[model samples]
Target chain A: MTTETLTPEDERRFLDEILRRELTPSRSIAALLAGVLVVLLCVYFLLETILALFRLPGWLIDPDEALNWVAGLPGTGPGPVLALGGAVLAMVGFFFLVSALMPGRRARHSLPHPVLAVVVDDEVVASALARRARLAANVSPAQVMVTVARAQVLVNVRPTSGLRVTDDAVERAVTEELDAMGLSPRPSVTVHLASTGVVGA
Target chain B: MNGTPRGLNRFITGLLGLLLLLLGLGILLVSLVPPVAQAWRDFAAPLVRGLHGAYEATPLPAGSSWLYVVVAVVLLSVILLTIRWIAGQGQGRASLLVERPDHSATDGEVTISGNVAEQLLRAALSGRGDLLGLHVVTYQYRGITALRVRLFPRKGASPQKLVQDVESLLEGLDLMVGHHTPVLVHLGAGTRAMFTREERVR
Candidate 1:
């Protein structure tokens, strides 16, 4: 293998670039929209309180009064307002649950770490982590997800006897499959040499 | 419904506005006609308020006729929850949109999909001389009417020789089964490897 190795300097620069890429536009947009919704909701509630306290004729200040006050407001029937409000509330609740529970925050930003877990047969490695490092290990990452983006897998390879877990073999197997499909950056599923079982990284 | 977040959100905001307009118009129309049956104030007013609250999904504050606390709660809850969820999913899940002509000028099109680069880069980084220095990309090019022989080097391989090899590789495939498009093999870019200029049919 006489191939010239890319200098350590090059490697460092590349890794740094990865971090910057993680803060993608999609994340920003989502955050902004969420903030706007919350603010608008709060504003509405505050106004209702003030108006009610002063006893501003609630009937005169009906939905009609609110609409005319705004610029170029469309006069839609009541149906749409109810439906949209309900849907937004429901979606928010679901989002809150999943975000709170999921452990890996890497995917939360722009770190496209597509992960797959091939669980091996033993509990030895998982048990050890639980006992020593208090790293709650799952026998499975629950489910293995293969995304279109580049995802590197962290595997616990406890291959016993005669099986040489060379990086090339593993890399080859995964890359070949991805290539034939016209996918790139071929995913590198990391292999963790372990004693008993395997889990996701 | 599958509209981008921007479009979807705007549509929603528009809906709220529409509701306001209708409410306003309804009031103006009803006020135009005299208060039906002796200005029924107390009983009917409360009922209308209740119905409007349910209809708008914005529960006006208790004993308050203004659109205040209730609107805030609904909007705030939805925004925070939605944004937080989005924050979890990472940013920009939207597909990269490319504006390309329907008909490509190049013979056959070349497309490199997601995550494929990871593998190629890994191979390039592998320090394996034989793996083409990792930056070599393989693509199929078909052009107007013909066949030619050429060879090509692997990523790190000598380009002149690679072109020759590439030609032979194509010839073996017998892609020229008919009097048709030209088959050209050449290396594409973003290649970290050093290679001579592209070699083609002599």
Candidate 2:
């Protein structure tokens, strides 16, 4: 093995690339399914063409006849079936286009580290935030809901009857937890307190 | 971590989408509009006639059509290529991690397998109830072998705490191996944690 000199900045950039690729939402399923469909289509045409070349009975239809039918499709004019099929085809195409264009990011956040690369899923952050909010607001586990998004964290709290939970308390708790975690591109925290409180303590 | 070229997948998907979009829109327009339908018919009639003329003119030794034979070959190649493309996705899992030539001996070599890191890391992290699962694998990144540790943390588990704990364990691993190996710690929510509530004290 050979040792090559790499600067600290280059090493960080390389690690960042790996982490980003790992966290990106995979499009392998879409690619695989589309490839299979294409292969099947090609197989169908190949079989028909081979049957025609061999002068045998067409498995489904002769290649020459299929070509003629496609060429004659425009002569048939607009019909409900034709219009519906066209619409469906367009929709499928549009879906694929969107999937390809979108970045398709997963709900994960990478933390800054000197040598070790670290990534944490949003669900874990949400859970931790919810737990902290529940503790700070003096509410039950079910009374607090924390939703973590790409750039924001929404913490909703339902206080017990006769117990007032301040918005500042929940906000400060969530902020403190976020500070402890030190996630990159730190998410803005939003605390929503329900007007109506739960009945039992 | 497995090697899956996401950019290539997106490109192929985009190309396929663009082709289908054009073909479908062309069909829709030609069917809905009378003028377009007439134009298409005029455009396709000559092409179809020419195709038929060529098909008839080209014949194989066995009295079969050479045009269809050519078409069959092209389609077969397309199918084979597509299958190959699909098979190439998500590969490059490394089974061996390290190899060092022993200078003291004439022909001695030292090798380390990926399973050594996997089992050691798994045993180190197995005591934590907050983690739903743990997976450690080694992959060749650039020219160096690196360890990828995937931690499936239970709901309400603090990922920061988990990361810190794993870092310490990795330090121990570094001492055992006599050198530091690059590591990536991923704290993820696996399907079990997503669908089920696993916390007991919460």
Candidate 3:
């Protein structure tokens, strides 16, 4: 049996690769709605077909009646009505097809690496930056709000009275921490110091 | 992350969408153009008459109608079941089995449960005041086993410190397991209130 051993660098690279790969969100809501609609339609058709076959009162089950309805639809009075119905059907179909084919977008940011790629979630980055900002400003976690976007990180800090908090220091600290993270396509950091301070110990 | 829609769903959606689009376009075109409308009516008359004649000729017997109803119900049930199976493609067990890298017949296979990993993580994170909650889920991606560590930090907790502690614990787990399992840490805010002041009524 041949065994392969990974060096430290190899292990680090593997870990980095694992961190880079993100799970794609499954648009279950759309799929579930579509599935439910299809099931409901099938159930309705089943009931109608069964009722009609049993010589009972049923709506829109007879093939002959359906064909007649189709044959009569073209000559139905208003041209605008027919056109509008057709347009609605076409638009619904178009949107359904597009959603079925499209993939879910990943809410992650890629970090720069020489031999390895790393991707971090936007929320995770925001939490980390918020923690840093809170520490740098010496404020409670509730006082600091961090928002991490594709190309920017916004930090809003609310300091208490008699406490001196420098926006530049907090901004520099957050920026340095982000830089140390080595995120690819690093986003610009903006720090905002709110004028009003909350009354609390 | 949830997996994308399966091939069967995509195929079904495409087929249904195309059918609807074509039918709608055909109806709109026939309604707008008089010549097309005339042509369609002329073509549909014979087909409609044939259908009507067929329906008239095939008069269902009193008791035999029940058989047809049963058949229709069964067919519809099958179709609905198929659609449900296709839609439920991604939800499966997230745990992965641990196997030795060496292709040795003498060595046996080992299975690692996600529950066990979670317990291990819980033990590692015990006594941390800043942590609100920790959850560990195992996922297999492209044949690699990964442990997704979800962390909820208490209010005012330093995320960097928490991450460092989790990283060290992961390293320790790797050493103990005799196999390297990469950890993916997801940090989020704690849902619990940090401090609740009690009202003092005189």
Candidate 4:
């Protein structure tokens, strides 16, 4: 609810440095499944109607008749068989989609890499900033599990904290850290600002 | 739309019953036509009677593989029951999805103070659309610093639309900054925000 005025360039620079987590297998599956389902549903209904108009099912003799027609394959008609195969494939695809999706990772389960975290002197505010960054990164407080020692800060992030989100602000925080060292002697802060590495492998 | 599972089952059942009734009526209506009607009168009820008799007179007993038969039946039934469930899951969680990920922005907008302000300001500028002109309402001057962000509605946007957009953006930001892992990072924090502003120049 506060307003800290910003210059255009700092925002740009920080955005440039931002990183994002990748999609979880589960969520990606769920989303793709949903899209696929929509498409399949439409195609299925349309094709069913078209097939009916052509009387394809009727033209294909019953299994008993088909066997009598030529080679004896019981209860099989090419048109109907193709339709059955398509249906089975659709079902399998749907199953795989649901199985692979992980809603947790897709929904609310990503955090910035702990690598971005730094250990600062106990008196330094960098430690606190890192803590907030962890929180602001939505690293579950339980997951972050912060600790402090003699002039030191430690952070532990959960593995599920990967997947893309709006990382602009977090990157901004990093840019701020880079600038804090005054972008001086080789920009140690900015160089280190790219700590947005993956966590827990 | 937010019906409970039990309620949904009941609704679907009722819908199916209504559909069956309509279908039956439609068949009866068709049977009333001249040629179709004549045929229906001669055979429809008789066929129905035949179906009733044929239904139980022939038991589909599997030879020695009755256990396999039972298992197959059970599996089929389970698949039938769960099929709709799987289909429903595939249904939208849909509509529009906005993604904002930073936890800092979760409070609205991220504010910066002291030396970090300039860097943070740069990142904020990278925002798209209405995201551009975010005002960090406060910054840490001295002592303990806190960050807050204000989200603005896009031009002609509704409150619902704006909230959804902002929340999703936050979600996206959170995803972008964090890593994929089980054990957490940012562990062991030592400072709490003290009410006293170390330096409040404005």
TM-score of chain A of each: 0.30, 0.92, 0.65, 0.23
lDDT of 1 by residue, A44-135 (tens): 65565455545565533544456333221222455446445445554554453333333322221121212100111112112211121111
CAPRI class assigned to model 1: incorrect
TM-score of each candidate's B chain against the true B chain: 0.25, 0.88, 0.58, 0.27
Error of 2 at B176 (Å): 1.4
lDDT of each: 0.34, 0.81, 0.67, 0.34
| Ranking of all candidate structures by their lDDT, best first | 2, 3, 1, 4
lDDT of 4 by residue, A1-201 (tens): 232323445433332222112112223334334344444544444443334333345333432233233222111344444344544554554444334332322211112222221111222233334444454455533343333332233344442336433445554553454344221121222111123545653
Kept native contacts, as fractions per model, are: 0.05, 0.65, 0.33, 0.00
Which candidate, 2 or 4, would have the higher lDDT against the true structure? 2
Write the residue-wise lDDT of candidate 2 on B99-200 in tens digits: 666668478776778788888888888888888888888877666667789888887787788888888888888787655667788887788887767476
Which parts of model 2 are misplaced by more than 4 Å?
A1-10, A76-78, B141-143, B194-202
Model 1: how far is B126 from its true place, Å?
31
Can you rank all candidates by TM-score, best first?
A: 2, 3, 1, 4
Best model per TM-score: 2
Point out where model 4 deviates above 4 Å.
Answer: A1-29, A47-201, B1-120, B123-202
Error at B45, model 3, angstroms: 4.5
Best by lDDT: 2
Top DockQ model: 2
Per-model root-mean-square deviation over C-alphas? 20.1, 2.3, 6.6, 22.6
Per-residue lDDT of A171 in model 1 = 41
